[model samples]
Target: MTIPDTGLRTEPGSFRDPTNQVFHLGGDVLRGLDEQAARDYRTLAGTEFFRTLLAAGKVCGTEPVDPLPGVPWTTVLRHERIPFVSHPYEWSFGMLRDAALLHLEILRAALDHGFTLKDGSAYNVQWRGVEPVFIDVGSFEPVREGEPWAGYRQFCQTLLYPLLLQAHLGVDFQPWLRARVDGIEADQLRPLFRGVRRLLPGVPTHVHLHAAMQRRHATASTAAVRDQLRAAGYSRELALATVRGLTRLVERLDHPATESHWADYQRTCGYSAEDRAAKERFVEAALAAGPRPRLALDLGANDGRYARLAARLADQVVAVEQDPGVVDRLYRRLRADREGRVLPLVMDLADPSPGGGWRGVERASFTDRADADVVLALAVVHHLAIGRNVPLPEVVDCLVGLTRPGGRIVAEFVHPDDPMARRLSANKPVGLFPDYRTEVFERLLGARCRIVRRLDLPSGTRTLYLGIVGD
Candidate 1:
């Protein structure tokens, strides 16, 4: 079928499913559904169960739009665009766990209405703040009797195994998930659990047994497995029971506390109470004076002190911190307060998230995705310049690339004589970063942005500068 030209552009990562294809026309995010998907959606939409879930915010809300001529679809659906699009790999442990539970919850709810989820891909889920919402409305279909849940294996791989790797072992799953978009496989995680550890409550059935089954059926045809499951009398009852078991298992999983330098940054940092308070005030005033940013980014947002403040001013805030534990703690606080305004992500500034997948366009790089109206770089320059050996000009250019034209950047410059800077440069030779000074930084920043205001704290070490991106 030929796609209609409504000035709509197809999203790069949205072409996997043929039933529904997502497109963006102007500011509206629309989903064009095929005839079969339209029929299923109509059937599901009539049920009260779907309405209740929509009202409760468990499912993303959709509005029907007239199908475009020659599109070969019965209807189009307009979805509420999320403020920021974050992948499963960027999520913290608790974030992934909550997404797993949300998926199971939606699956169980659909099954109750004589419908079942066609697949259990973690990418189908996205976070609206700290809450997990199911975004794939076309994944639902009429349930088949005497058939095992088709998404069972996918659920284990995409959700269950990744959670197990983190909860059972202290291994962080972010890097693995990012490398393999489908998530960790059963066989991959099986070797990590040995002896008594394998006997853990849900590990055997979901991990060990599942891995064994995959190995035994390595060469078996898909139809052969279906026939076997059919002969064994797989029913909706069994599927529901499996969902219940997974719900309990995932809910019980938690991210164990790990040692991190940034997790205790506020306490260990040598900043006096007066100095810290002065920095906070400077950030607040800078935000107030600038245009109310619709989207703000906080680089090296350790513990989210400034991120929370940015949330008060901007419509959305993306807080990037390298330390996993710090991001986890920040995520917990956002969940507790139900703060959807700020999103906490774990990323190392020295090496930010790179672009890859499908000719390097499927997933965008960190710099590509971080186009914001305002950026806060509080107390992070020394780490990149002196600690990581990055030139000051490169750091300034990267920060400039993140801000939109006319956007504002509130950044702090740590003097070489400061304790933090001295500590970072202790082992390095003297001439490593000779140009790392406030004047040099201002000169570099002046190329792309106009300095609006500057504040020198009483500590006589750090200075805050507010600049607007050049036209």
Candidate 2:
């Protein structure tokens, strides 16, 4: 059935699946399903397994909605909005591992019930706080007898290899994921496993053999392979076994963060008891003075201390930290605590995530999604101004830009004489950053925000300013 066109904006990244299309109208996220997809959903949604997952919050909350007037769809469904849309590239190692396991668990359950996911794109998963939720309801389809799992290779590329990259090599996967959305090819990953690493569990089969098969069938017709597999008696039991094995391997994977220094900053940071308390009181006072924020940003959110505080006053908080190790540790804590309001991300503000995919609009840039009701830049200005060589004015401007007009900003300025600031600038030429002073920062900040209040920390080396963004 076709409905009159409405001004719904189609999600640029969702064009791959023609059977289902995602769109946004006002604040609602909508999906249009074709006849086949609608039929599949009707069956899938009725399953006990699906209901259990929904109850456990493993899948996106969905409900049938009145037909939306935009696309030609047999039915429509509305999805609960994710607090902040984060890409796999922005996820910590633990986040990716959790998402991978969630996918395999769903697939295993789906196969048990004579259903399977049609695609294994890691993008199919999103997060509500630390929990991973599968968002592509249309991916569920009746299991085709004799055909192999269609999503195996995609899963390996997008999820497994990236995890293995970090777990085995101690390399961060964020850059690789950001570089190619399709993920690392089996052939590309197979070469990385050398000597003793080649004997790692799940490596020889999932990587080496998978790459060999890719080369052998590079020019073969995919239809012909399905026919051959059918003749060889590829059964649902075999597919289920494969999914179970993958789930085990993913669960066994571990990424022990050993390289990032900032991961333990909270313990080593030279903040006396009085100084720490004073800083907390200042931030709490600032947030309490303003309207409770619907969304808040905690940049350089090491250990998520301030982010946890922000969560008390904000409906949702996006805790962004450049160190993957720090983020991974933070994610583990949140996951254990069942914290569902703060979303921890691994992102370097110096080189934040940018728009990519189809026409560079499928995935949005960091700045594009930075709109927040309040922003906390605590203990962050020095990292950008001195460590990254960002000028004072530009730093303040960027923070102010992230907040909506009349929104609040709680920012801390570290004086050049402070121990942390001195250490950050030690390697630089003498007097290289002459302008990184209290007066310069206050002046620049005042230009963009009306200073609400200012407090000098007990240490006498730091200052906190609460300001309202100007139009």
Candidate 3:
């Protein structure tokens, strides 16, 4: 939604650091960095630290971009755009912990290479598979001997504490973090996590200890705290050692709960013989009719059941789910299974990823990655329409938009008379899609897509409609 990525919005974005903003123009994204931050970015980009990261394959590729010839007081760096952007909160436990460790690793390396992270925010990292890659080149600043890790308390609260809370206390800290759009404050977690001896084994020492230590910084005079940090040996080597320690702790974290969807998929979805046969018939027919779609977006891919079926038709599927547990299982299966071609991602379609980064150039909005050859919205519209109260037509538009022109849309309709649909509308009958009935649906299809076929299942409640779009 920034100035450079899309022709959609060239408006300046709401981002921090006051030094830069991002704008979009078609496919290219532009960053607006202030003169001071631009200088810092140039120095950091020229440094061997970034070179080593690229050399080591730890980050997305970057190239120095020429400024708009007459643009004033800003520097531009063109980054190989990530197909989609996700946040630590949107990340599964494995993803969040991995990102936290990545932040520490990047900071450690930056220190060794004569630079330091200008900030420690969870927003700086993105995942390439399970690997957390650094996306912020401008966040690094040259460090001198006396300065404390300006990001110390920030790192502990942002990375270490939330992770420990999730791993040890079995809390889905994402909602808490999402509530506090900024990182989780240490004080909030400290009181909640205290007196839990049962959690001792999984609890990292850093979370509690760091919070206690940070209290002193807030309580003491700024001069006294800075002096104390210097006295306590907050040098470059110390930052590296601290970060390495956090990394080791993060690595040791397994998901706090072993009850994950993919691991338990067969158990939970042990669909009755009749149910399985019905769903399979619908999926197989859809796949057989469509051309091989190289990319597919699975809207509500709970444990990737139908998505996996459609994968029989696509080269890769980005399975989207808001449940971290489900996404964790999905990620593990995609990464570990030898037959894997799925990219499991955590996305709440209701509030998909939004724009961020200095001037918004740093991270692309979540919708930027919506392109797909076939879009599967199986058993998903119910949740969006009834659960999220989104209108059916709007939901249909969103799903259909994900596919290319002539791309296929696989949609499932649940009859209002069905028991499931009855329960979904228990609060109030918000009205069924009366206009999208047999006649209207066909006409709508004629306008936008050719209705290839409609499968009316033996069960009266369900139907699958496949349509190939028109130009």
Candidate 4:
């Protein structure tokens, strides 16, 4: 058998599972499996249900590959590479909900085929733009005769609790998910559902009762408890019913309609038809001036107005915004349109995602993954510089770095006198942001990018700039 030229590099995020390890060789995503996992994979690959899901794009496509001659692995498989790997914390409410539902759907289908997922981790699911696809094929195992769902607690912690936190408590789950990588425990969530909220569907069983059981078995050996349950003949039917119950609960959950300043910014934005049209023309000219990009980054993409335009010039576009509601609304629209090239993520550029998980390399930082050929920083510089207290030079530097050499940057610099900028700088001491000047801004942009075009919008306070990065 032919060996890969480069040494196999294991995917950092996939180290938790001992049965299999993911590796990257050249452009191929390969996974090495132990004997038991290899057996399970062979069985799963032959199943009609697994094949159907793979064909339908609900699961990551996979096929067997030859094991390395010197490797200890019994089998090796290759999986389709996801263009971008995003985490649950970066997902909007709609995106997380869809992922949760997909997990349950896959689990139910697996159960019907006499197999079950060994664990439920939201991280196992990745996105193909607006759609979620399961990527952890090694998670599948043949159902044990009398075993309960092993992934039940993990499902509640990662998927169900996060949804309930948003839908039931009107709390944004992003911060919480980011704070705890493993996810919220039943005890942590149970407190929030107190009083009359205890009566909420699925709370009594999944949250309250689950927490109580955990406390009751606080000192009990896990193996002993699992063995006792198996001895008592925990039926697969019960696990299926539980999965169905959780699915129903998740289906009914929805993020509350909270007012977001930016979600409706397009309508409330003080822009005349002519001005908006002028802005669009300027952006279009910039995008058309360059080679079509493989990837584009639309910073602070409110309502996806410019992201959709970038999609026309780029093979793939990532629309990022700070407000989850805004991203969620945009995601729903894109999903409805079946947009497979534009991925919308909830991110605050001021505190962008960093390399995290084991030694901070398992999950890549935002900058690590973002190497855009076309960058749209329209109407966002002021927000990052003034609103978030980020320095002007830092803001310009970030934009320049995101745009690869020879790439293009479409950015808008809002004057400190602009109404929006004034609002963002409101109540601040005079000279608090001394560097917030139009001259300073241009100098910074010029230092890093070759100014291709500049247009002072009809609104005197706003200026649109198009620059090309030089090698």
Q: Clashes per prediction?
A: 0, 0, 10, 0
Query: Against the true structure, whose TM-score is highest?
Result: 2
Alpha-carbon shift of residue 292 in model 3 (angstroms)? 8.1
lDDT of 4 by residue, 200-282 (tens): 87789889999998898899997877888888878889789888888888888888446778878998777778879999999
Off by over 4 Å in 3: 1-14, 18-23, 32-49, 73-75, 197-209, 212-215, 219-224, 256-295, 305-316, 338-342, 347-373, 382-407, 414-450, 457-461, 468-471
Writing each residue's lDDT as its tens digit, candidate 2 over 142-168 gives 999988999998899899999999998
Weakest 10 consecutive residues of candidate 3 by summed lDDT: 5-14
Tell me how candidate 4 scores on lDDT: 0.89
In model 1, residue pairs whose N, Cα or C atoms come closer than 3 Å (at least 3 residues apart or on different chains), thus clashing, are: none
lDDT at 36 for candidate 3?
86
**lDDT tens readout by residue for model 3, 326-362:** 8877666665764355666767888876655454544
Candidate 2's TM-score: 0.97
Off by over 4 Å in 2: 1-5
TM-score of each: 0.96, 0.97, 0.77, 0.95
Candidate 2 colliding pairs: none
**Model 1 misplaced regions, further than 4 Å:** 1-4
420 Cα displacement, candidate 1 (Å): 0.5
Q: What is the lDDT of residue 68 in candidate 1?
A: 69
Error of 2 at 57 (Å): 1.2
- Deviation (Å) of 178 in candidate 4: 0.2
